[model samples]
Target: MPEAHEDNRPLIERIAADIRKKIMSGDWEPGRKAPTNDELQRLYGTTNVTIQKALRILKAERFLEGRAGVGVYVRNERPQTITPAHYIEPAAAGQSYRWLTEASKRQQRGKYRMLEVAEVTPPVEVARAMRLEAGGTAVLRSRIGFLNDQPAELVHSYYPIELARGTRLADRRLIPGGSPALLEEMGYPTRSQDDEVAARPATTEEYVALELPGDVPILEIFRVVYSDDERPIEVTVIAKPAHRFKMGYHIELP
Candidate 1:
């Protein structure tokens, strides 16, 4: 432990973060036994009380669990893989959303709650992606997606006001086949998409809205969909618990 002045965070928080790092980095694989209490104390140069407190933190966060005299072990809630390719296209007419269908293929019941739909000034990054002028507003659609009745993802999609002003994208009700289908009908068929993925701590709104279990990193995706001539049509931002999702991508080398 660094001097208190050097590392102002509480000892418990610091130690918990260290252990969480090991787990997230795959240095401590799931189902593996944790270090002995004495072993941890010696490693951290801390006391038994501090070590116990840190372990409790991890336990409450579901990263570790105690057994009846069997010692503590890492839990088996590793991230599941998802292939973005499986969900890129528009759902056919009269069909449900693509995301719902894809989730079903994984044996997980899927659902979503539309939280908001309105015209709002988008974030700078979103505006830039869609080439909206400063202070320009877009039609914003927000929802919380659930798997097996558990909230799992928060999605916000923005559409250019020019195209969405008189369409379902600006409506409060759920679109029958999702935005991609509606866009295709309006002649903005999705030609290609680009996604920038990242990870960071959740915002306060996300933490409460998603009922996050702990302070785990959130996987963030900023995706832009284009039509013919590479005209940007929609921008979507998705956030989910990073520890619970593993995005799979396939690349072709020439």
Candidate 2:
């Protein structure tokens, strides 16, 4: 079997990938019409069937959307590029969540819906990350995130019961400014963090929750936030459709 690399991909896939690259690189900005089938066929020196197949890939990935009797166009709501640090801070004492705050700054509507909340035994890795004893349980806060009314991310954050038992974190309602603020007020004060990112095929549940357009890989982030004295306060597992989002990181050197 051939390895899954650019060189080893079938012709149609490579063509689709190149077009995707153009869109991602901003060469083909959102709202712009994609090249016509005839034009794409001529450009790639391929047949209409191949061109159609390639375009279908982009459509399935949501990089393009077609209108009845009209041409395909780049999607208006472009994939979001999230800078982890920007939303890592606890929201101001009485403001909206940092997620909403940052989205407004970008001229977009950020929304959240609480999917579940319960004290449960988490996966072993989560248990280890939260430093809980074997068979220990924690408060789980699961939510689905939206941007411009479209589902964008699913987050499951686990908190130490000591910090959540009497608070909204254990409640099934959405947090006002997110749990980070409550954690701060309780004195843990999110002082630092660790992140582990991975890419894998979407789970059946995640595929349905994120409403992914196809059987595509999803970006999964395992994050642990700590407070003063290196105490872990929050451990979150985030899942987003891989084709519709990217992470940005910036480092400053003194």
Off by over 4 Å in 2: 1-6, 68-70
What is the C-alpha lDDT profile of model 2 across 1-254, one tens digit per residue? Answer: 99776587898998988998888778999899998999998999999999889889889888889898999999886666878998789898789999998989988899998889999999999999999999899999999999889888999999988888988888898877788888888777988999999999998889999998866788999999999999999999999988788888999999
Residue 185 displacement (Å), model 1: 2.0
For each candidate, the alpha-carbon lDDT, in order, equals: 0.90, 0.89
Candidate 2: worst-modelled 10 consecutive residues by lDDT: 75-84
Error of 2 at 171 (Å): 1.3
Q: Give the TM-score of candidate 1.
A: 0.84
Residue 245 in candidate 2, Cα distance off native in Å: 1.5
Q: Give per-residue CA lDDT, model 1, range 108-201, as digits (tens).
A: 8998899999999999999999999989999999999999887789999999999999888998999988889999999999999999999999
Clash count, one per candidate: 0, 0
